[model samples]
Target chain A: MSIKQEELEEIYAFAVQLGKDAGAILLERAQERFDGSKQAEQGHIEKVNAVDLVTQTDEDVEAFIKSKITKQYPSHKFIGEETYSRGVSRDYLIDDEPTWCIDPLDGTVNYMHLFPMFCVSIGFIVNGKPVIGVIHAPFLNQLFSSCSGKGAWLNESQKMPLTRNPTPPLPPNAPSGCVFSCEWGKDRRDQPDSNLHRKVESFFNMASEIGGREGKGGMVHGVRSLGSATLDLAYVAMGAFDIWWEGGCWEWDVAAGIAILKEAGGLITTANPPADPATAAIEEVKLGSRLYLAIRPAGPSANETGRQSQERTVREVWRRVRHLDYSRPGV
Target chain B: MSIKQEELEEIYAFAVQLGKDAGAILLERAQERFDGSKQAEQGHIEKVNAVDLVTQTDEDVEAFIKSKITKQYPSHKFIGEETYSRGVSRDYLIDDEPTWCIDPLDGTVNYMHLFPMFCVSIGFIVNGKPVIGVIHAPFLNQLFSSCSGKGAWLNESQKMPLTRNPTPPLPPNAPSGCVFSCEWGKDRRDQPDSNLHRKVESFFNMASEIGGREGKGGMVHGVRSLGSATLDLAYVAMGAFDIWWEGGCWEWDVAAGIAILKEAGGLITTANPPADPATAAIEEVKLGSRLYLAIRPAGPSANETGRQSQERTVREVWRRVRHLDYSRPGV
Candidate 1:
């Protein structure tokens, strides 16, 4: 199931084309938002428009993607968000099957508000590993795509870091005081140990300034809940955000982003304290882990100072916000 | 000194041209971010680069704007962010002398980090009221502008709301559950009753759930700190955000936005309880009041129901997250 770098690039280009087509459809539908039909479904609520965003467009776009993928790779299996939202269990394996994971519309809420943070994500997986990824943000007119070792880019010209291709590993030193991103997902069941409490505390920990929150505080510049996870990971890969720790988003949300991010030299680990990607089998990272700590992309040649600085930041953060385990053993 | 509608429109057009020229400068400088030379001066800190940011660009842009204004009006008094940052207190009269409020660069941190949320804000004033405003976000390529009675607009082609010219006043109803925007200003000093503490509590209150935060919890959807006060107001005027509560930003940070928001049919008041903007003296709402609650814009001829719905949402939010008074009276 090993994909040639050349094959992956071809697939990556195709995925990008598919993303562009899907993005065009999404953009047109977004403008009709003012038509107002608040049919909130699949946990997508527009308190203002009350639109029945049961997101028919979501399915239509996915269907379009699957049709295009099948035309090229008839044997590739497909996993779409709408299907998972329809109650499909999170039990798919990246095993032998060549798969195309799709999230027709990531950031549905932002799309509902026309807040300019939604995207079309497509990832190609084989032997249970992502080798090609494409994330197109139509409104922003920026597209991020990657093919394993071929390097990652924005619109295929602006190599990430916009400083150098393949960013060096984070400088190892004390955390450089980062701005973070987190979210309070739709799961609002409240209790002392509930997801709501954990997220609130994590957010507070990130924004709490020096001399606050005891040992659990962070010198993070701030925390933003932009109501979208894909953009969070994509932006972090771009080095705009320092980290994105989450426990509620699904596989489709991270699949493509994880692929693109890795290509750019970033690491993704569980959100809990021991999120040591260094020791974990990279492929063991699950779509259902439900927790991810995405650090900014670094370059392979990251110098000792850079590595130490980045490691210092990571260690400090892990000490403060520990996440509850949501991953199962041996997928 | 009352400005006629026609005169205000002309001024707005002139102000927009100034903003465009200024925006071109800001955008070009942003490209040279890797060319970092943090000059720690005048409370501006570029911790990592520590290059001499002694922002000659800020001065350069301000001088550019002032020269253009003097050429046009010849006698207009100008208040720029860099000048204000240089110790000119916010105590000037909104006197008969036509004045210009400028923020050559809003969201300086976002600018420093290349986060795509910064902008150039230009506001024209006469007789103590903002008559014309222009905000140009070069990266986003979206320009928001307006005159008192002519209505707000985006790129001057798509009107604010982009659908309804003037949005209907918020309907009278329980808090329709809003998406909020907030910021943690530079003053991080903490105390049980300090402004820092109040902001932290207010932020937590908005995001806390049903049984959370004692009686001080709101059902607001989420919050974002995009690092720019002017853009926050401009977006709310565009109907993308519901409320922006701040007690740390200055007049220049909000003057242009206030002019744009008012023109779009929105309300501006103190962040504390009983923020009655309909009766608040327009001039009394100073550039340094330091505590302003900007409501979403409403449509012309808003129905009673719409007005009450919007008011209800506002009152509900105020009840949950009340601000401590931070304003000085008798301006």
Candidate 2:
């Protein structure tokens, strides 16, 4: 299942092209809607409720990417957000087989609104791990790509973290100086103890003054939500955001992003606090875990390696956030 | 003194160039930080609190812009974030005389994080109204500009909204289908009645299901925070976001944005609901109101004009959000 780095780069280039082609489709569809020439889009937009949404562009781009990838790699398996939502077999989740995981439009809501945060994501996975990934945001004109053992990049030239140098070490007090990212997912039930309520409460705790909230505050420097988990992950990979703690997103959301993140020297772990908070070993989250924590690449600290800095950030955030449950269907 | 449209466009051009130059400075400073070569920035950063931040670049850009503007137009008064923060007289708040309001670095937090949401905002006001506006985001390569009687623009070629056409009508059901923007500002105390807590609660109510929580939910189509009010304002002007309800930001934060929004045919009102929900008249917020609601341009509906659509959207949001109080200095 181990592919040569050269072959992985080949797949990465294919994915980069596939992602841009798909993004072109997204941009066209969005432009039509924005131009008010998309009277049919109103009928094309089907809501899974008021919060969760899917558009015809989502389906078209997913189909377009699937067709192209299958044409190029006939033997490869494929898992796509639109297809998976239509009741695809769970056997394609991840396995020893080479699979292409795609979120044709990662930020569908943003795309629908012409908010400029939507993108097309493609990840090549083998042995249940992403080896090559590409995410193209047409509106922002940013394309992020990575291959195993090959450094991550933006728009084919600049190395990620956008610094053209090694990422700086995590700032002192770690998450206290961090620009934290977390999403308010589609589930907005307001029960006293619902995950939605807990998520909001967690944001409150993370943003509260250090001594103002009964020692429950993390007082992270800032909180941002761009309405797209994939972009959040990419920014974390680029070192724009120090950490991204997310729940209720799917494998398609993080599949390609995880590849770019790891290739850029970042780390992804379980969203929830580990059972053993003091455990030194980092446990990467499963592809379909539905909850994830991603920390940016950091240079080695005087007393800690980059891995140790990421681990510390993950655990400190674990202390401040309530455990969130996002179950996969039939899990 | 009434100024000609030609004069406003002239000021708009000047402001656009000034914003670009200011953005270049911001980009250089941010590049230095991200490049890990900004040893001086460490000493240059000064925090107003754990959340509020200022940098030497903020001060330097302010001084640079002040010098440039004063040299070009000696009679024009200027108010900038950094200079005003160090204590400027209130007479410049919004007088009969022409004044320039600048946030040399509007999203300082984003700039410090290299998050790409920060920008340089230059606003020209005459007799208490934003007449000429420009905002430049160097990282995103976006430059938004507007004149009093002229149209708003992005990067000077594509029109605001990027549709190359008039804006579409607001969707039926108003905020129910609206992409909403609101900021979690620096004030993060967790008192039961604190503005921060209430703001969070309002978000919960706005995002929940239509019938949930005894009718408090607005069931907004989406909630997004880019961590920059100016960008949020710019996007609203571009018709990317349907409505933005914000509190606790200053005149410097929104001055230029108001001009762009108005030129793009968007509406600005008090963030609070109207005293009478049944009233048909739309009220515009003052330069220093601290609470503001911005709605994107809309084409006419079956029975409602574009203005009516905006007023309806504003009132619908008002019904769901708690009233917020953010006082101006020594008011």
Candidate 3:
């Protein structure tokens, strides 16, 4: 059943507060390590060998969030990063009940390094669709929140895109003026056909000179790898990043981001185009696909609606990027 | 003649204020574009092809800074990004007189995209060595400054590394716990022997598993590309980034950063290792070399001094990275 606006607003407020509380905890723990304390010196060794400290923090944060959520909503389903990694079945991802998909510490590696790109993400899904989202980056002092009907916001004051007005339309020649973001994920094998190889090749193509590199050149304005999928998605929602595509991350990583991005008028789809891309509509992919392509919101244009602009950008990106394969663990 | 402590302090204070003022000017111009104003819409088209708007701002900022500096120090030689780009001899870079090296607006691409990584950087060089530096990133609300004898600082309050105490020693395995930063610069040719190709391969080698990829892997903890060399250098000073290696950028791009990095107890050398890696001293590279490798400050270790740890880390990285070629424009 569809929830009323009042209930949605309440849920949104709760999630935002939860995100802030969790982010504060993370910052407290991270501060000690960042200051090169004796404890941090010891943890540095653990980080290199086993990531023990990060794991401990991740588990603590996840448990903290889960306890609060369950206390408030005993019937809600839960999917969390630390718990899922402990061997939860993928089937829980498709449950029809109101589900809380949370990544307590999204950029564990960045946090471990004290790089300041980590965050706490909370996404509320109803009937397999994300309806509310909240992300808090304590170091950045940014809190992004959104609900199904209400618009997206940053810090509860500035709106998404930070434009104060409508978002500017996509560049006339898409990707030419765009600021694209992608990641060199954990999988770093160097085989000629490995996903890492494909990623490297794709990054090269996008950054190459236009009409150079034998039709592979995209000549996009710039490419960034921020090491946190959640932060990348959050920035995309703000219209600072025009496009983002990646593979091999889990559902919790992008769930909240997807909710915020949609509320900001952006579009999300599979990294790979459809079989009949010419005529088929570009539909959003299942949350478990482990592949994603997100483009910023499009303002009005002379020839087409905002949706058309987004779809055409996706098609153009697909033509330039190689097909990436990322299968779920059990699928 | 060497500058006294009193004179150096005066110069440092002046440079910091100048950086802040220039940063404010840049932020004002950038704010109009970031808000999707009617002016930004027209500038968007110019950005795609001619980059006229960015060039105009870059020139304006440079002129504004130069005018101020000349009025204050009538005899100080100035080497600015805009002026040097127009065709200045490399010989001026080695002048014995006190020189002000400035990039009024660094990370032009990031500024044009409203990406929040751009900044103003100013360096005071004397006797061919950078003695004082200041960098102001208005969007990030960060100001980094340093002098030869004095230590580096962030926002004039927190010391570099943000560590209340001494920096932690380097990891026993060097690259294992390091956060490495690099950029895919403007030269994006895909040829096998090109600098871009070598840079990409080195990035791959560093990111791969230790035993994988034909022993080319160094297994660095994480790799980031933040799109601005100055910010990368400043972060390195803060010990947030453990290592940064890059080539093909100009002296103005890194002059201020080099000063700050050194004052923070960090080390800088050529990205390419010395011919006899085991026996040679890893001396600092010349500013005009257009190549650099910077490592964060090291605290005391069990077996070696802080400098020794930095030296060994450099050698280890050089073993894993390939040589890059970046000649001057008219050399």
Chain A (alone) TM-scores for all candidate structures? 0.86, 0.95, 0.93
User: Of the candidates numbered 2 and 3, which has the greater lDDT value?
Assistant: 2
DockQ of each: 0.33, 0.58, 0.52
Model 3 error, position B234 (Å): 0.8
Tens digits of per-residue lDDT for model 1, B110-200: 6655567789999888877787899998977889998877788888886776435334445343233465778765554445677767777
**Can you give the lDDT of residue B173 in candidate 3?**
84
C-alpha lDDT (0 to 100) for residue A124 of candidate 1: 82
Q: What is the interface RMSD of each candidate, in Å?
A: 4.9, 2.5, 2.7
Shift of residue A302 alpha carbon in model 2, Å: 1.6
What is the interface RMSD, in angstroms, for predicted model 1? 4.9
lDDT of 3 by residue, A1-331 (tens): 4667898788888899999999999999877765557335342324324322345778889999999999988888899987886774654365678899999988877786666788999999988888899999897777899998888998897677765455667877777778889998877676778888888778777777677668767767778888889989998898888899899878899889999999988998988766766567788867888889999887767887778888888887887787788876555
| DockQ of candidate 1 against the true complex | 0.33
> Can you tell me the CAPRI class of model 3?
medium
Q: How many clashes in each structure?
A: 47, 0, 0
True contacts kept of 1: 0.19
Q: What is the interface RMSD of candidate 3, in Å?
A: 2.7
Clashing pairs in 2: none
Error of 3 at B113 (Å): 1.3
